[model samples]
Target: MIMAWWQILLLTCLAFWMIIDQITVGILCNYPLLIGFVAGIIMNDVKTGLVVGATLQLMVLGVGTYGGASMPDFMTGAIVGTAYAVMTGKGGDFAIGLAVPVGLLMVQLDVLARFLNVFLLHRVDHFIKLNDTKQAARNVVYGVFPWGLSRAIPVFIMLIVGEKFIRQVLAVTPQWLTTGLKVSGGILPIVGIAILLRYLPTKRFITFLIVGFIAAAYLKIPMLGVALLGFAMAIFYYQKTIKSSEDHESNSTVNNANGKEYENDKGEYEN
Candidate 1:
């Protein structure tokens, strides 16, 4: 499963693009599914790419690098994992298992990139104080290098040398550990869901959750059907709540106006 030089170059470029897109453009090119698909195209294996990408996507869904917090780098995982999977003829499960550790390892790289960007920020600030507008703008553009290299260097190394490392590790690793890794991969997505639930109004949405679970578990409804049901419920709730609030406000306004008019009439009669 030797990767051609062009394939390695393409992957390196994808890695660079992912970080730059996240830090500057924010076009969601860093997302796992997209990364996987592009890697798949580069490797001439779209199906494997989709499977690997979707698996990583599910695992990291709803987990974000909000407030400068570091999370697993699923984008790198997807690109590397999909390439490895396609090259080695390993199934999606192995790719998924590989992704967890790869993503976790990438967290350090992400932090390093951010830390380096701080220096760039300082340089930009210095230029601003000197009133060098052109230099300040150039400094901002220069920040992209650290971020891009942080991702690209690791990806290039992995694509170039990772196959032999993976094969060697797989040969010596126990079967039980391998199975556990696969199981852990399957379970990791629940952590993402739990993180999402922490921010939700769980008590208010508990009933809907129960209904959805039942629909999926017992009634065997497809995910699309469940999603549509949820959408309908949201629309219904929004309309009902809005109408009730509007009616209450309208009634209050009318009653206040009528009471004022009655008071004026009574005062005139008394006078």
Candidate 2:
């Protein structure tokens, strides 16, 4: 697929907006799944976009940029991967292969963006002392440019490089390398899920977990059905737990009241 200038510009803009969205009005545009879906729509390949986004999203599950720490830029990976997957007509795994290095490389750019923003922060401080509120505010917005560009510039350049170049690179890539990518692509999500489970109270809800696994893996229940069942179970447990807590609190309150009454009555009789 020959990518038009408009498509490149649109995708670049989307990439630019995502980082700003992350720091400011976060509506989960920072998520790879949404990025991929939007990118796929731009490429006229929603399936590829969804597949790429979903795979990367799973891989990044339980991963965070907490406390200003940067994780791999999988969101960009989804955009590039979805675009190239559509353009190259390659498999989702091949797209994953293309995305892995790009995501890792973007990490350095992410750090660079933050480091550049430090200067803006300093300027904001200076303006605070000078009371030039407008310049400080402008600089604050200016700070978003580096962060946006860190993602946009690379995606724009890469997309403009065209499908011919991508096909050529794929032609030169070894079968073993591609195979490895497919395997790793599948494995990474499991690792992400494992990481997620580690932080969840899995032991307390082990039965639910076991049942879900059985329903999905053995019974081959549709994911939607499995999800609904899980929801029902969660609601049931939540209501039951609340009821028990309320009962315990009521009993405690009654016990305390009876004890106080007993003490008062005994003191009156002694008097």
Candidate 3:
């Protein structure tokens, strides 16, 4: 796969998932499904890719990163796991199972990335204090670009160099170790979720989490499908809420104006 230009390009793209994941804040742009889908496309296994993407997406659906804290590393797991699955003609579940520990390790990588960012943050602050706008911009580059490249470049090199070695390793590993890795992988994300829930609005939102799980686990709703449904519901709820608020504001303005006008009329008559 690495021999072909297109394959290399796609794989390079797969590595950039880290950069994109770093930059984007929303659920839409995050790692899991996007990486899986990309690998699937590269391998001509779109269904498996999409399925893997969606499954991993659901597993981490309730998880979020707040204030640069560690969360499961979905990018490594999604891209690498999907690539392995595609190359080996394995199922999406295998990709998901394998991705778990990789995802957890990724959290540490993210923490390292954040630590690197502290230097940049300090430089940016220094620039602000010095009132050196141009110097600040330069400092921002010094801080951000290297970190972004650091995230992408090594993974690209390693994925290319280590692809074959990984396959061999996977083949010889015992069932117990593989099972342990997968089980540990699956369980590790729960800690990420717990971390996320700590910063979430409240326990009330937990019900929505359960409902979403049932939808995926039993009803077999794809990750994309569930995400779209949730989006539509949120949009509907937002519009309704906003409209009601606007209506109340308008009504309050009218009432206040009428009261002012009536008071003015009484004063004029007395004058």
Candidate 4:
């Protein structure tokens, strides 16, 4: 299936915008859901785009590029995968299979972009030492190119070449492998959660975690309700901890004052 030239241009623009957005604006446009939605609009298949976007979003729910660490790039996946699915008349499962691997492969591209940014940083540093403020600012702005290209180049190539390549793969790939990819897509979200748990104060927050899980799993509470419950619990915990600390401080102050008074009386009596 031949994607229109305009469609290719639009997707590439989005890919570039999302990467720059992650770096500068941080308005979360780089997320899979938004990418998929826009991609769907471009591809004239909104429903399929939404489905692919949401699925990819879940797979990378807790994963982030924290501290410049590499994570799977669901944004790229959303664009390419959704396009592939819509073009090929494949469903969300097929899209997920295609997207997950694309996301994983893009991690290397992310690292390369970051490595290139180091040179820009050094240039900025040199300008700073020379006391050339304008050049320093210019160098900082120039840094956007490396990042934009890192995402945009691959997206362009994929949009042009991926449809045929994916069709070929699907044609030759065994049923078992296709099924496995779908299953792996479903399981991939757990990895994001596990990574998140590693950074969380699990023991400290375990009670809340369990409560949220139970509310959702057993009580059949909707996610919004569960989130509200969590919000209320957070406020209660904050107040309780603050009150406890204040009371302890007050008691310590009273005890110290009483001890000083007793010492003075004993000294006066001795004199």
Per-residue alpha-carbon lDDT of model 4 for 6-48, expressed as tens digits? 9999999988889899778787565799889989999999998
lDDT of 3 by residue, 83-185 (tens): 6667655466566777766677666666776788788889889989999899888877666554455446645654675457766887898888877655654
Instruction: Supply the global lDDT for candidate 3.
Output: 0.69
Per-residue CA lDDT of candidate 1, range 106-164, in tens? 88987998899899899999999999999999989988898889889988988888567
What is the C-alpha local distance difference test score of candidate 2?
Answer: 0.90
Worst 10 residues of 1 by lDDT: 57-66
Q: What are the models' TM-scores?
A: 0.87, 0.94, 0.63, 0.79
Question: 10-122, model 2: which lDDT tens digit per residue?
Answer: 99998899888988988865689998999999989899999999988887877777877988998899889988888877679878878878899899999999999999999
TM-score quality measure for candidate 4: 0.79
Q: Residue 115 deviation, candidate 4, in Å?
A: 4.7
Best by lDDT: 2
Residue pairs that clash (backbone atoms under 3 angstroms), model 3 = none
Better model by lDDT: candidate 1 vs candidate 3: 1
Worst 10 residues of 4 by lDDT: 57-66
All candidates: CA RMSD in angstroms?
2.5, 1.7, 6.1, 3.4
* Backbone clash total, candidate 1: 0
